[model samples]
Target: MKTTRTAEGRVRAVIYVRISQDRSGAHLGVDRQREDCEALAERNGWEVVETYVDNDMSAYSGKPRKDYRRMLADLEDGTATVVIAWHTDRLHRSPTELEEYIDISERRGVTTHTCQAGPIDLATPSGRMVARMLGAVARHECEHKAERVARARLQKAKAGEWGGGIRPFGWGVPTGETATKFDKATGEEVEVPVLDLDKAVPEEAEALRVGADIILTDQSIHRWVRWLADKGFTSTQGNPIGHQAARDLLMRPRNAGIAVYRGEEIGKGSWEVVLDEPTFRAVVAILSDPSRRTTPGPEPKWFGSMIYRCGLDGCTETMICSRSGGANHPSYRCQTRHGGGRRGDKLDEYIEDLIIERLSRPDAHDLLLPGPGDVNVAALQAESEQIRRRLTDLAGLFGSGQITMAQFTEGSDMARAQLEGVNKQLGRAAVKDPLVPLVGAPDVRVAWKAMPLDQRRAVLRALMTVTVRPARRGRMPDGGYFDYETIEIGWKRSAQR
Candidate 1:
């Protein structure tokens, strides 16, 4: 039979130490544990690979530490063969975690040894059983301690005793006195002993109260956090209270005198409630009302307020929507005939009707409609591609520090303009008849209703471009109200194309 070597080349080990609180003066167990582990490693010819210390973190919840998890990962990856700790309890105070650790040790061939408990050989059935039993006892102790603490807190709360936790917003513990101190400014209780009203300046106290109100009413906890940071408020540990702390402070109901601790009120006698019961009820009612909620309004009309010049010469004024009649019968009058110009001719709604009738004809439709041949897809694609390339290049230049801020901005603007032009061209090519089709489409009404004011301007720009010049009366072949003449209507499309 081959004998297993008692000592390998060199045992690599990691040391993990922890303390739940800064009670170093009361208990030097952690220090002593560390010393013992170090001595053990030296005597066994083992190298201390790394030391992971998790101070002030209770292992009751089996909450894994960042450093502890990293050490585990390293062990699995062959970084360390052994783990050294004060005892099994130091590694984990929970049975579930200890069982997991034992399984990992057995599978990964990693050894766990404690300063007081000696080696935990998980590969052997007897050793594994002992470890599991120890883990159970530790977990039971932790659970029992937690239950006792919780019962004590509940009893204190029922008796209206100040169960130790966070301090209330406005009340503070009295200085050199047994009672709590009340904030004169907001009349709220400050529960923290160090944050007494006498210690805080009048202005600072006022600001804190105001910031707390803003946080509660506006639900802007971030603003309150910023205010606390600026004022140099910190936790009991002398570290700044994080964003979560500010949120908790604002949400605590004990400051408002409504918090039920066990069966009694804790800080009721110390602080005044900012939001009383009646006011809170009113706010809830308003928030729950459906009628108070806001929704988006209707879209604006493109030519709702703009003036449109008529094509008939001698018209005193341009065509306008009728105030009394419906939009369909709205007529354009020659300004001169109406009273200002030469030969005045009134262009009734018949002109618009005639234009619509002509557009419906197959011959006219073919002439106006955009066919496949009319669209230059390749040219449009090239223009879009160029714009995209320019945008990318400008972004690259900005990233590489090759272009100044102003230069990058200018390049971006130009590229955007080019891209917009290409998009307009493509849009126009897709339409059968730019002006008429848009006006006649059934969806135009919906589009008009859905569009905003800015989008309305874009629509107007797409339909018409130039001012329609009125036709002269004598220039018409027949100088009568009923005269036949071909109308020349000029309009502008978007310059983007």
Candidate 2:
């Protein structure tokens, strides 16, 4: 390409390059842009002053680009008389930014040049009009590209194709036997990277198991993060996981081999589930519940004990865990109105015994309704599977050119909407009572004591209600005393056959 030299002087030129994705992995795109812009500067007899690069940041993303901002600052300071880029769009994909550039160029007497699109003569009316039109086109192309990418990702999600840099916990990247390949062009042997999951990370899987089984004792996400850290576990990025990130991982349906898209679980996924459906669902419930984040105080000594309120008329206060007779005696005491307290150990034992008897019945399952929705989980699963198969078939037909893009798009959208609706329904479906098995175990007492406080609390709450009253005055056994009327237990009337 022929070009004229700078008639004024050897003007200093600044070249800027940016790339959103580097498919070549060697940053060849930016390198090529720099080389071409250098050649353009050489042709104009301009001094190559500096080069600015903003890698992996899209010009249209609206995210602040450090290098791009620095270049603009340099321009404002009158450090550069000429700006060089591979193309106009390489510098900007937004028309507003293009306007800013135009204003800056006219004000600073800076000439903008592209290695490919030639010089942008801002002084003339025709040049400005052409520049504006090119900027408009670039902006239009960017919007369309974004729309296309979003649609493609949605389609990929529907197909249950995992797409992310960080791997989900409890999952292992597979390794395979490497095959030697002789590259004919390069005359070198290369080992192919394994693409299958034949290996498992035992430590990662174990960490997930420990977390899933933990009772909802610590409501804070930080508790789990600290726990995982103590276990010497970190995220795929090899950094300590944050509270929000840990919660996100624990709540994902993908851990249960359930397909999810855009914050909704579609159905069973293609990958093997690390956790069973019930346990996974339980984790999600505990983490997602807004009430799980109570006021940041001390952890509860007894789960569900706070539910006990003062039964005395006109003096209502939720009982709290407190210590009695030194550290040896922990009790639930009502701080409001001083309604007295009950020994935590004794209260828990009585409740557990009551629960054991209630659940040991022949018709114990008739008590609580699963959930309000009462959705048939099996039928939902089947219907979702059918929809997935239909989608696959429709995609195949489109790929073979048997169906138009419009037809395929319409069909896919309809199927996805249905799948999402069903997923919402499934999420509300009541899971089997986890405590029921323990209740029906060989030894109810052993099972009750062995259970986590949260699990025991769940059973105690479902079967009966406990009312804790103040101890009788002047009654003592070993520095503390509680009358028989202090603890009152009642079975729910609705629970009766």
> Evaluated with lDDT, which candidate comes out highest?
2
Q: Backbone collision count in every prediction?
A: 20, 1
Worst 10 residues of 1 by lDDT: 339-348
- Alpha-carbon error at 221 in model 1, in Å? 12
Our tally of clashes for model 2 stands at 1
Q: Which pairs of residues collide in model 2?
A: 174-197
Query: What range of 10 consecutive residues in model 2 has the weakest lDDT sum?
Result: 1-10
The digit string of per-residue lDDT tens for model 2 on 1-497 reads: 11122346667889999887764345668998899999887887888777999876788977888998898888888787788999998988887778888887787777789977988876567778889998889989989998898777767666666655455666655575676655545666678654333223677766665666553332345556667988888887688886777877877777777665566555565666676654565577766667665444555668546766666554557677777656687777776737556777777665666677776776666664465356677787688778877887887899899999999999999998997676555555634454555644777667767865555656655566667666678756656555656566667737751
With candidate 2 superimposed using the best TM-score fit, by how many Å does residue 383's alpha carbon deviate from the native? 4.7
In model 1, which runs have C-alpha deviations exceeding 4 angstroms? 1-8, 21-32, 177-252, 261-497
Q: How many Å off is the CA of 17 in candidate 2?
A: 2.5
In Å, residue 51's CA in model 1 sits off its true spot by 2.0
